[model samples]
Target: MGAAWEPGGAGVLALPSGRLVRGRSLRALPPGPPPQFALYLAARPVAPAQWESRWLRWLDFRLPADPGAVADALREAWQRAATERVEIACAGGLGRTGTALACLAVLDGVPPGEAVAFVRERYARRAVETAGQRRFVRRFGGLATNDPSVAE
Candidate 1:
């Protein structure tokens, strides 16, 4: 896997295992190879035609506001990363997508508070930009608790 930064903070970051995760900008892609799984966290409703495969699921962050939802998505993405390829994307990459990827790094065994830094150092110098995004990373659970809402 390889990573390249793009405009709007949307870029592909290569995992340690050689898989790539794109934040937000991945939605416009055409299906090719199926990763172990794919997750789309959208603030708005997406067309059903836009989604493909049983491994794919659509999540809304606006309603039902379960912050833990990011953990569930991370679990699936990590599983995919271990074997097949995986990708997690959101609107701006730095905001929601970066936050989710940072939490995913925690799920990948990075410490909760340090997860954001890990991603930032490896992916981009400015990965998580918002206070809320940093808080999400700090609250992210390591291997012990998979709680999505784990408050720091």
Candidate 2:
């Protein structure tokens, strides 16, 4: 695994591809330069026009995100992480952010069944907080394909 950008900080998970992406609660963002790209998940739209971010209306606390959008967003985030600082954030960060991180892990070649544990072990003990979210990660393998639809 690649080293975290900020060890023991909010949370950072390294993809098998060697891309390091930070995961944090919008409330726990450390003091420092902002990430070049941020993917924000929330019940409501929280990203402002001024931030270089993408907001995915995730709504429920532990429910999975829209499958279609999740695939596209993860693909974008993964590609951006290759050459830029990428961060993923949610309300408290552990649940949604962790879920997203696990999906990214799957996209990076981790088996879907192990993706959740992978994120929790590296990102936070409480990562990927809901049964539904766990199920989402387990089913994420299909989204790992290089189909162009994932980028749309």
Candidate 3:
């Protein structure tokens, strides 16, 4: 449950329930299979040093003005969360981070329509605090809500 999110593109944070919430740096693809579970955040242009990574696979891209990365991350997150793993997606915590959280919320059984509010209330009061980011959350795929009305 309660875990401090370290500053980075995205990472895997272990929740109190022993779940792994993975964070990732939003970039392009390198032609390969996506991670087991992940959440992507589409933010502004990233510098070269931001591109630097040793362990996680780097999806090469200057930056993002789209939701491709977020979608991929959400897909992974959904798979992991289904197994009761703690999945997280963040971009400096707040805007992009909140947006990714909202997507994760949807994957965690929150209604696609109310995913933004769900993330904001549970993850952060300031989650997805932007029009563009909100839009991304609304459209993101990959979800597993417990609410029968919204479950898929």
Candidates' C-alpha lDDT: 0.56, 0.79, 0.46
- In model 3, the Cα lDDT at residue 5 comes to 30
- lDDT string, candidate 1, 42-112, tens digits: 65544443333122233332211455455555676766665454556555445556667777776666677
Clashes of each: 3, 0, 18
lDDT of 3 at 53: 20
lDDT of 2 by residue, 1-152 (tens): 23235544456677778788999888766776568888999988884835588888786556545667777888998888887778999988888899999999988889989999999888898998888788878777765564444321
Q: Which residue pairs collide in model 2, if any? A: none
The candidate with the higher TM-score, 2 or 3, is 2
Q: Write the per-residue lDDT of candidate 3 for residues 13-122, one digit (tens) a residue.
A: 33323344444334433232234433334333333332222122222222234344345545555455545333333344556656666666655556667977765555
Look at candidate 1 and tell me the lDDT of residue 16: 54
Q: Please give the lDDT score for candidate 3.
A: 0.46
- Lowest lDDT block of 10, candidate 3: 51-60
Instruction: Point out where model 2 deviates above 4 Å.
Output: 1-9, 144-152
Which is the winner by TM-score between candidate 1 and candidate 2? Answer: 2
